[model samples]
Target: MAQNLVLIAGATGQIGASVARHVMDRSGWDLVGLSRRVQQHVPCPMLAVDLLDAEDCRRKLGGMQGVTHVVYAARYDHAGGELESVDINLQMLSNLLTAVKDRPDLRHIHVVHGTKYYGHNAGPGPVPYRENAPRSPRPVFYYAQQDFLIQQQGGQAWDWSISRPHTFCDLVLDEPRSITLLVAIYASMLKELGLPLRFPGTQLAFKSRTQFTWLPMLARSIEWMITDRTCANQAFNVVNGDAERWSALWPAIADYFDMACGDPEPERLARFPESHSDIWCDMVSLHGLRPSELSTVAQWAYGDYVFSPEWDVVSSMDKAREHGLTESIDTRQMWRDSFDFYRSHKIIP
Candidate 1:
C-alpha cells in the first residue's frame, strides 16, 4: 500500500492545529505541519517556513516528496484594511502554490475560509447563507484564493475543496485571538472580581442567533472532503448543526463559573478586558494557575466582535449534510466540554 502524506500549513493556529491533531490520530496517514514558529505540543513533524517569502517556500517545500494532500489554513492579518489584507493573503497563497505546483502525488488541496465570504463581517446579510450565495462587494481574499485554485487546477491532476466555518471553538490555551479562550478568561476574571457574569453586549446581540464550528468538526469535514469524491471542487458551510441565542445561553455559561447572570451590559470589549489586568493577576495567584499576563490570554477586540454583533450570523449546513457528512454537536455541550478541557489543562479556575 502507498503511504499518504498530508501537509498542514499554519499548524499552530486554531484550525490548522486541530486538523493536524485529527490527522495524527488516524491510521495510514503521515502528517507534516508548517508554521513560522515551532509548536510545542503538536504530535506531528513540523517545518519552520515563512509562507510570505516565495523563495523561502520554494527552498523549504519544494523537496517534500510524496505529499498527497495540502490543507491551506495559513492566514495573514493586516490592520491597514481589506485591500492590504487581500494583497498579502493572495501573495502568500500564490507563493505556496508556486512551490507545490509540481508535486505529482498531490490529490487534493483544501482551503479554510470563514463567514466573511458572505459579508457577515461587514454587516447583516441574508440568513442561512448557502454555498451559492453571491460574493460580498468588499475586497476579500477568499475569492482571490478560490480563483487562484481554479486556475492552478486547469489540466492538473489535483482537485480543490473549500470549507467555511464561523467562530471556531477549540482547546488552545492562552491564545489571544481565540473567542473561546477570551470568554473563559473573561468569565474567570468576573468570578474573581465578585461581579456577575453579564451579557456584555447589546440586547440585539444577546437575542440574535449565532452559529459556531467546533474545531474537530471542521477538521473532520476537511478530511471527508479530502477522501470523499462527491465533495470535490465544491465549497461547503461546516457548522455545528444548530443556531443559538446568547440571551438563552448566557445562564449556562454563568453557571459554569458559578456566577449569576446579569442583564446586558453593552460595552466595547476591546477596552473592557484591559481594565481588569490587576484582577486577572490576582486570580492567577488565588487559583494557582499558569503564570501568564492577561493580555497574552484574552483578546478584547475579538471578544467585542463576537459579543457586540447586531446581526445574526447563521450559515446553512444543508450542503454538507446532503453530501453525507452527518456530524453534529450541541452548542451548549460543546462549550461545557471546552471549559472542562481548559480546567483540566489548568488554563482557567
Candidate 2:
C-alpha cells in the first residue's frame, strides 16, 4: 500500500485544527501542518511558513516529497475591502500551489470555504443557497482561489474539491471570532452581574432562521472529500442539516447557565462587551476561571456582525449527501456541547 501523507495548511485554525485532529488519529495516514505558529498539541511535523510570501512558501514547502493530499484551510481576512481580501488570499493560494505543483505523488486538494460566496457578508441574496446558485457580484476570495486552482490543475493528475460551511461553531480556546463562544461569554457575564441572558439583537434578527457547521462535522466531510472518488472536482455545502431561530434557541442557552432568557434588546456587541470588561474580570476572579480579559476572549465586532443580521442564512446540503457524505449535527446540541467544553476547559465560569 502506498503511504498517504496529507498537508494541512492553517493547521491552528478552527477548521484546520479539526482536520488535523481527525487525520491524526486515523490509521494508514501521515499528517503535516503548515502555519505561522506551531501548535504544541498537534503532534505532527509542522512548518512555520508565511504563505503570502511566494519565496517563503517555495523555500518551506517546495522540497516536501510524497505529499498525497493538500487541504487548504488557510484564510486571510482583510478589513480594507473585498478587492484587497481577494488579491491577498488569491496570492497566498497561488504561492502554495506553485511551490507544490511538482509533487507527482499528490492526488487530491480540498479547499474549505463558507457562505460568503453568496454575499452574506454584504447582505442577503437568497436563502438555502445551493451549490448551483449564481455567483455574487462581489469579489470573494473563494471564487478567486477556486478559479486559480482549476486553472493550475489543467493537465495535472491530481483533482480538487471544495467544501462550503457556514457559521463555524467549535471549542478552540484561543480563537476569538467564534460566535458560539461570544454568546457563552456574554451570557456568563450577565449571569455573574445578576442580569438575565438577554437577546442582544432586534426582533427581526431573533426570529431569522440560521444554520451552523460544527467543526468536527466539517472535518469529516473534508476527509470524505479527499478519500472518496465520487467527491472529486465537486463543490458541496457542508452544514449541520438543521436550522433554528434565536427566539427558540435563546432559552436553551439560558437554561445551560441557569439563568432566565430576556427579550431582544437591539444592542451592538461592539460596544456592549467593552463596556462590561470590569464585570467579566470580576467573574473570572470569583470563579477561578482562565485568566483572560474580555477583549482577548471575544471579538465584539464579530459578534455584532453575526447577531445583527436580520436576514435568514441557510445552505442546501443535497450535494454533499448525494456524494455519500451524509454527516449531520443538531444545532442546539452543538451549542450545548460547545458550552460544556468551554466550561470544562475553564474558558468561562
Each prediction's Cα lDDT score?
0.86, 0.86
lDDT of 2 by residue, 154-254 (tens): 99999999999988987677888899899989998889878999898899989987789998889888989998988888889999998888889899999
TM-score (C-alpha, index-matched) for candidate 1:
0.95
Task: For model 2, give the 10-residue run with minimal summed lDDT.
Answer: 76-85
Model 1: per-residue Cα lDDT over 229-319, one tens digit each:
8998999999997888888888999998999998898877777756877887888888888888876677777787787668888999889
TM-score, model 2 to reference: 0.95
How well does candidate 2 score on lDDT at residue 125?
71
Per-residue lDDT for 221 in model 2? 85
Runs with alpha carbons beyond 4 Å of true place in candidate 2: 39-41, 77-84
How many collisions per candidate? 0, 0
